[model samples]
Target: MKIAVMGAGAVGCYYGAMLARAGHSVTLVGRPQLVTAVQAHRLILEAAGRTEAVPVDATTDPSGVAGADAVLFCVKANDTLTAGRVIASHLGSSVPVLSLQNGVDSAEHLQAVLGRPVVPAAVYVAVDMPAPAHVRHHGRGELVIGPGPSSADIAEVFSRAGIPTEVSENVKGVLWAKLIVNCAYNALSAVAQLPYGQMMKTDSVPETMRDIVAECLAVAERSNVMVPGEVMSTVLGLAASMPDQLSSTAQDLAQGKESEIDHLNGYIVRAAARLGIAAPVNRALLVMVRLVEAKAQSARR
Candidate 1:
């Protein structure tokens, strides 16, 4: 398979490396630093006290996606439209595009921008870029892609690369489930600069998480998304499962980079307004995170 990964950050590099290791022709389109590092030393994937240098094609230009049979749109939520437009111009209209992003609406947004079908994927992985072209995997690496004509073949390709992949008919529900989890923790963790375990230890934190989860659930129901499984347990279990792990939003804030609060809690707030429901807790968290982001930007100046 010829695969191209756009915005080759943490998640993109991890999966791209795996596929490259599996003998696929994988191209990673990313920043100059990453492209230079990859061309010099290949992609360094570190996990479980082991490391491997996975060789793959890498470039800083979106044109690198030209010959790809499939594209993994792995950019952050805010970059979806811009990256989609860039890649759309270079890639063939028939190429399958999978959106492996944080938010529930990324695929739809990409589709609107590209005027093509985009498969939504629920990514169950914890990864980070410690340095240019170096990807660290913290936990699970599985994907649930939305049903489509090419979904089964895409899932097979991923499975061969050691990533557990499934073609799911209920991808919308899967996305909503992940969204609820993000709504519960991303902003709180970012604001407090704490890991899930430490933040949940504080009194009233669990109750506050419950409030946020309830609001997200109401919004999901209003949107007709099922949100399968017990969402509250899933939200709480993340703290225990990855006690030392920091939310991606927290890492973004600490690095003075933009956080994805707008797509997480802000999404809920907007959905609530459309449904005539109040989401005060989610709204407050979103506003607080935005204020922190603004302050961080000002401090950098």
Candidate 2:
């Protein structure tokens, strides 16, 4: 399969590398820095106690997505529309765009701009880009993608590339389940500069996470959203599952880049408000993350 990874950050790069290693023709559309690094050393992937360099095409131009069989839209939640526009005219009309992003709305949001089918994928990967062109995968590279005409084909391609992919009719619920997990951990992890295992060990952190999960469930219920699974249990199990994993928001903050707090916990806050309810706990965490983001920005100056 020929694949193009748009917004080739950690999530994008990680999957791009895996597919490339599986002998797929993969191109990464990303920043100049990553292009430079890839030009020199190929795409560096560090995972499972080993590091390997995979030769893959990469360009700073969004037009790199032009000839792809599938495009993985993996930009941050807030940058969806902007990135979508950059690549809209370049993509083939029949090309499948799988949004492997942070928020629930990015796929549909991108589809509106491109006027093409966009597959919403619930990404279950713990990964980060520590350096230009270097992807350090923590654990779990699975996807629960929404139902569409091309979903089965997409899943087969991904699973063949070593990424477990499931086509789910309840993909929104999967996304919300993922969102609830993000709300419980992303802010706290970002604010504290601690990974999940370490953060869980801190006093009052588990209790605080429980509070966030409860509020998120309330928002989903009020919005008539069905969030499947034991979300609270999923929240509690993260410490053991991905112990060294830091939230993507944490990675952004650590690098002095803007974090996506507004889309995670802040999404819950707005949803609650729209339903004439309150999500004080989620709101508080949102505020705290914003404060830290502000601090990170100020210090960067």
Candidate 3:
């Protein structure tokens, strides 16, 4: 299989390396820094206390996807449509593109831009890039993608590459569940500049999270998405399971990068409004994160 990873961030590098290690020809397209490092050495993947220099091709041009059999679209939510357009002319007309990103609408949005069907994938992993072309995996790495004509084959290939994968008929609900988790934690963590453990210890944090979860559930209900199981318990248990982990939003802020708050809590707020339901808690969190982002951007300026 020839795989093209559209983003060379942590998620892309980690999965691309796994496929390369499985003997698939993989190419990563991204920024110049990642391209330079990857072209010089292999993709340095650090996981489970071992480092593997996985061989793969790298390029800064989107045209690197020209002959790919499949593409892993891993850009940030805001870049979905733009990235889709950038790669559309380079991709095969019938190639399967998998969106392994956060937020519920990325796949749909990208599909619209490229005028093709895109598989939506819910990614469960803790990954980071300590340096360009170097990916570090901290914990679980599994994927649940929507059931489609090509889903089974994709899942099989991913599984063979040492990635746990499932083809789920309820991918919408799964994505909504992950979105709910992001909504409940990301903004608060970023605003406080705290990890899961310390963030939960702050005053009124639990109550705030409860309010956010309630609003998100209400929004999900309005969207007719059945988020199965004990959602509240799962949201509450995240801190205990990953005490020191910082939300991606927090990490983004710390790095002076644009956070994905608009796609997380802000999406909930807008969706709820469209359905005539108010998500005040989520709206507040969205604003708070935006304020922090503004401050960060201003400092950079």
Candidate 4:
């Protein structure tokens, strides 16, 4: 399959590297710096105490997605529509476009913009881009994608490429579950400037996470989204799952770049308000991350 990875950020780079290493014709469309670095030394995957170079084509043009058999849309949630617009004309009419992004509505947003089917995947991966061409993997890299005309085939393709992929009928619930998990951990890690394992060891962090998840579950209940599984257990288990990985928000703040905090906790806050439910914990986390972002922005200026 000719796969196109649209963002080339941490998640995009990790999956793209895996797919390319599996012998597929993979192309990464990213920033000029990434394209230049890849052209010079190739894409690097650092994981599990080892590293290897992945073979893939790289380009800065959105048109690089042209003629791709499948597309992985991996931009931040905030850039969903903008990136969708940029690549809409280039994607084939029937190609499967997977939104491997945070938040619940990216696929819906992209589908509207592209006027095509966009698969929504609940991506669980701990990875970060240490350099323009280097992606460091910390832990789990599984995808739970919602049903689509081509979801099964795509899932099989990913599985063959060493990516654990599952096709689920209750994708809405899956996305909501992921949103709640982010609500529990992301802001805390960002505020503490710590990885999951270290942050979880701090004082009263488990309690704080419980409070946050309680509020999130209330919101999910009010929204009538059947978020499956034992959420509390899942939240508690994350630190162990990706001990060395920092939250994406933390990475964004460290880089002095904007994050998808608004889409994560902020989305829950909005849902709570709309449903006449209280979400103070979620609201507080959202406010705190926004302040951090504001401070980071001011520092840059």
lDDT of 2 by residue, 129-235 (tens): 87999999999999999888888998998899899999999999999999999999998898889999999999999899888998989888887889998999999
lDDT of 3 by residue, 1-301 (tens): 9999997788999999999999999999999999889878889999889998999999989999998888999999989888989999999978899999989999999989999899999998777788999998877789999977788999999999999999999999999988988999988888888889888998888888889889999988877899977878988998987787788898898888998888999999999989999888898888888888888788888
Collision pairs in model 3 = none
Error of 1 at 234 (Å): 0.7
Q: Considering TM-score, which of the candidate structures 1 and 3 is the better prediction for this target?
A: 1
Candidate 1 lDDT, tens digit per residue, 1-301?
8999999988999999899989999999999999899989999999888999999989989999998999999999999989988888898868999999999999999999999899999998888788899999888899999988899998888898899999989999999999999899989999999988899999999999999999898888888888899999998899898777788899899889998899999999998999999999999999999999999888989
- The Cα local distance difference test for each model comes to 0.92, 0.91, 0.90, 0.92
- List the lowest-lDDT window of 10 residues for candidate 4: 215-224
**What's the lDDT for residue 285 in model 2?**
84
lDDT of 4 by residue, 1-301 (tens): 9999998899999999999989999999999999999998899999889999988999999999999999999999999999999999998889999999999988999999999889999999999988899999988899999888999999999999999999999988999999989999899999889999999898999999999889889988877789999999999999998888899999998898898998999998998898988889889999999999999888878
Q: Name the runs in model 1 displaced over 4 angstroms.
A: none
Question: How many backbone clashes can be found in candidate 2?
Answer: 0
Residue-level lDDT for 81 in candidate 1:
88
Worst 10 residues of 1 by lDDT: 239-248
Clashing pairs in 2: none
